[model samples]
Target: MSTTIPGPVLQEADWHRLLLLRATRPDVVARAYAERRRPGRLLSERGTMFLLAADHPARGALTVGGDALAMSDRRSLLARIVAALEHPDVDGVLGTPDVVEELLLLGALDGKVVIGSMNRGGLDGATWTMDDRFTAYDAAQLAACRLDGGKMLLRMDDRDPATATTIESCAQAVSELAQQGLMAMVEPLPYQRREDGSLVLCKNTRDLARAVTVASGLGTTSAYTWLKLPACDEPEVVFGATTLPCVVLGGVPGPDPEQDLRSWGRSLTHPAVRGLVVGRALLYPADGDVKASVDAAARVLRAVQPSARV
Candidate 1:
């Protein structure tokens, strides 16, 4: 008599066979299941992705909403982030775990491109300015949460040995993320300790070139790596650095938002620039209109490329 396996066991065997098939036929499997299995929800079909930077608090940028420590007001920041997320033009957001956790808790992260800020120990007011420690979300945490990727601030002060450690740690982080198939955005700045003992972040042409080289060469895999750069005073100098994709950082809000947008627009058109990662300029605008600011930034991103900007 022909013996038959139990129905459940037979089904399990079939499932294993299918998994093996998929493993061998990666292209077909990816087309069929990768999208569905993707961790975070992807941005809509809009060409450009606008990442709202709200990680100032982690760097001691607590002043907002007219309160010096307004960023500490999680409620207000959460509301603002939710409102930004609701905007049709806003693509994604950039923030530390504190803010990302808030977004996740509020259920606002669904279908959104969530980027975790990896390092924030180099507080703006810290005495040990060059000693930037990876005190935020890490690759393992990001993978555990099924998060999309991570971003780290790597400010190198040649004068300070602490920067060497930061460089090594960042390199390991990049390799770890790559091994896990996660993306990592590295913002490298050549910095120096000033005469007054304060850290002076550099944006000069030579400095930017060094920063780009260091960032691009980090980690074992550069496929998923990206550069977060400043809108250099001299666009030509900054844009000439590396072929790696770049995202212009929206620094502290200035007196002229329009000019700021114009500069950002110029950078967006640069060959190396991939997109924009702005914070105070768009989030804490002088007019306090997040939607309008986001819309304006989106326009710049859209104008640069006909394809989906993100």
Candidate 2:
């Protein structure tokens, strides 16, 4: 892999300049948003998507790997995002309103698939974490901003009554986004509250399958619903639960990068699997090589080329 910077690097000086622009001439953000080049289709010619996920921080989930504050610095995070988007294989970006606005102001989202992340009201360790409310970009905002779609995190906890509210909100969002012909990327994660009152992902194959089934039938219509899921031990089973187009998420990169890559490659071979909506695995890799890590995953997506488009 090459070590060259693909696009304009956001250095310390660049960050300072952005701050000045934001403080003095705030209209540039709006102008940048208006001037952003939108993509004609979500997928590329080979029928694959490589979206960068940056919405985790909005939910107060900023911890990546061993570093507790790995994503705490805005400048560093934006720099990584800019570098990732410069890569040819990176399709688009999925982020909350703030992150999206910052990226737009930086002019890094041109010709990219911009998806707004909705329902980030569920704070990471809050007692009401199950109540994933629509506290971010709504359908109307997404359309107004010319974003390609809206993504929501739907974690269903059987014991938590707040899960019901989340389901209802997600259903409404799905319907609303569909009405505008926008993608509603929903991630249905089955979670279990630990004995210590913390939430942990239920990666069991059966649970994931159940979550997929529930998510696939959320809205009044499933015309524009897309499932963003984590590839589990039983990749086929996790994906077999739905007929909807699925995009695998690159959860925190595991200790073994080779195994992680292989898992993603195997899942991409699934008929329903369209592409990848990854974040930390590519942006904050074990080797700290953002470009190389992104390129490696791009190669995995391209390796399993389908005979037809989804």
Candidate 3:
């Protein structure tokens, strides 16, 4: 009993010391304590991700319904997007914030995964090429809107340091989004400068590997990172680049829709390839049947993973 008499005094002394220390360094102590708590929560199973192919406007090839830059026509684009969202197989949409915001305004985004396109300043025919600015939505802006994720394009022209800067900024953006526990799809391409001062993207096996390596090396954690890759000239070459999940991009629409769909479907079967992010091929089809085209595209996506049956 006599030996235990010092216990209460020591405890009281320790409490007083902590209180005094905290008072002197309130902000630091509070930050440390707050950080000990969880940062945020992840989306639930209700969050079904999909391949969003809204790349037309970025390239300024928005010719839906025979209207050049038809995607720029907000009303028409919104209607088509709403129709696609209504489909049972569609889990999400990938587009710039202009489109995403329009969907939100129309109340079409509830329970849907909305991915914001983050770069488009490097317009298709720009003179000062390779300076791809972040002209679209950003991570912070996305988070503010309660959006799911963000995506960026990285076309590397080694000769152009401007493109290199875009790459560096993208790397930093990836880290930022990772910290927020949101997905950031980084689509990288090794490009060459032509004699006419135009940048041509490479789809060769070697170039594909380099792009994958560069992308994979970015950011702190890659758990939420995905790759938006082009359907390579040789599907096998694209498949060999990285084991990371990939969604194939739909370039300009070809004359043959069925052949295009078949090729897209085959790419879906590749082990690492998840789905297709096709835009013009689906939205601006020659027939002008948006729903029919979207349905066909969805069919291809569903076929990739049999378990993803609608």
Give TM per candidate.
0.81, 0.94, 0.77
lDDT of 3: 0.67
> Best candidate, TM-score-wise?
2
For model 1, how does the per-residue alpha-carbon lDDT over 1-310 read when each residue is reduced to its tens digit?
A: 1111111111344445544654675354323322323324333464345677877788886764345765665555665667677776666777886577545544566666777888888888687656778888899887776678889998888888888888998999999899888888899888877798877778787888878888999998898788888888666667667776678988766678889888888777776776788876776555556667778887777788644243
The order of the candidates by lDDT, greatest first, is: 2, 1, 3
- The residue ranges of model 1 lying beyond 4 angstroms of the native Cα positions read 1-47, 64-67, 305-310
Task: Using lDDT, give the best candidate's number.
Answer: 2
For candidate 3, write residues 1-310 as lDDT tens digits.
Answer: 1211111121344435544654675454323322222213222232223555665576565554345555665445555667666776666678885565445445565656667888888887776557778888778776665667788888898788888778888888898888777788898888899999877778787888788878877788777788877766566666666766677777667678887888777666676776667665666556556678878887766666654322
Give the winner by lDDT: 1 or 3.
1
Clashing pairs in 3: 62-69
Please say which candidate is ahead in lDDT: 1 or 2: 2
Q: List the residue pairs that clash in candidate 2.
A: none
lDDT over C-alpha atoms for residue 208 of model 2? 95
In model 1, which range of ten residues has the least summed lDDT?
A: 1-10
